[model samples]
Target: MKIVTIFVMMMHITGSLCAQVLQDIKLNAPDMERGLTIMKAFGKRASATSFSSKDLSLQDLSDLLWASAGVNRPENGKRTAPTAVNAQDIDVYVLMKSGAYLYDAKTHSLKGVIAGDNRKMVSERQTNFANAPVMLVMVSDISRFRGDDTEQKLIWAAMDAGIVSQNIGIFCAGTGMVTRPRASMDTEGLKKLLVLSGTQYPLLNNLVGYPNE
Candidate 1:
């Protein structure tokens, strides 16, 4: 029954696939050396550069994604972000030319979300996610928090996710990369592109890329 169910799901995915499908990339970033450097270099907005044409190799992409929100140490499920009550309510969805992926911190890699260059839908920035090699969308899941007061719980999740988002900024600065986090995204457009479900919603978007200047 399980195998049959899986087969049916696969068929469904293959039927409605888009272009520029994502390849199952190999997870092979050695460690956080560059990541750590990025953390320091861009710590608290030291400077900002225009990243227009810098290209990132597979390994570089792997490393950046890991540092953005990937888990550094094992033993505990704790990630680079601080969660309110450890709710971990936020999900970081990475949009790129290849496709979109959900960052798997524990494994320090990406898991495919969908096939195609859905970056444009996530943001109205530029050509082919130009200058910015990586674009991170921070999403909050209300179910992750526990509180009778609706507003308070959501506020907590948003604040917590902000902390994680800033860490990405620092990482970018450390790596000579440029990034801008904005909530001014095309929400409706992103929902369609990401294939969001009943409980998911796009909260914030960050543009990360090599500076052109």
Candidate 2:
């Protein structure tokens, strides 16, 4: 009887700890008509405004990041965006006011990439990050492609990264925020900043923020 009681207590503690650590998160919004229509309204138009430096909630950030590249459909492990040959070579590095993190598609969580708020490293101009809340650095491990032509492979990978980037832009539009897929970045600087030693190249960056109105 004493052994049974102790085992039950241990099980309860374990369950509570698991619940605390593994949070269940999902996207919530103001219904489809209101949300989807607005999101679709912007289509391909990049945001014209900039976001103010305000702390966004975990829900907001999670949904935004999920919309960027999270897996939507279940069957084949496909995501909101398409990848060339489904190689999924593109990796998204999220630089926020706190630190840098990588998107774990399978776990639907942000894993630490680097331990610092190095948003300025993403852009030379401080203004670029001044009103920004989150900046996603799209990287590609070019070696993943076993194509005969290396340059063409790089081009195709870049194309895939662009697809995912556009999704983020559209998602921002839906949420009444601002976003811009910026190619005007110091790639080498970013690679070093994010501590990308070899082959992991920062291809593009997308800046997101709540519009300063």
Q: In terms of lDDT, which candidate is strongest?
A: 2
Colliding residue pairs in candidate 2? 51-210
Error of 1 at 52 (Å): 1.8
TM-score of each: 0.78, 0.78
Q: What is the C-alpha local distance difference test score of each model?
A: 0.71, 0.73
Q: Tens digit of lDDT per residue, candidate 2, span 1-213?
A: 999999999999998765434223333431323345753747736755566787667766777777777777778788877787787778888887667788877677877655556787776564645558788888987777776787877897889789888878787777777787877676777877667857677878888877777
lDDT of 1 by residue, 1-213 (tens): 999999999988887664435666667864545544433564446434455655566776776666666676667777777788888777888887777888777666777878766666655754444446677898877777776777887788679768877877776666666777777677788777777775566778788777776
lDDT of 1: 0.71
The local lDDT score (0 to 100) that residue 20 gets in candidate 2 is 38
Evaluate residue 49 in candidate 1 and report its C-alpha lDDT on the 0 to 100 scale: 41
Runs of candidate 1 with Cα error greater than 4 angstroms are 1-21, 35-49, 125-131
Q: How much does each candidate deviate from the true structure in C-alpha RMSD?
A: 6.3, 8.3
RMSD of 1: 6.3
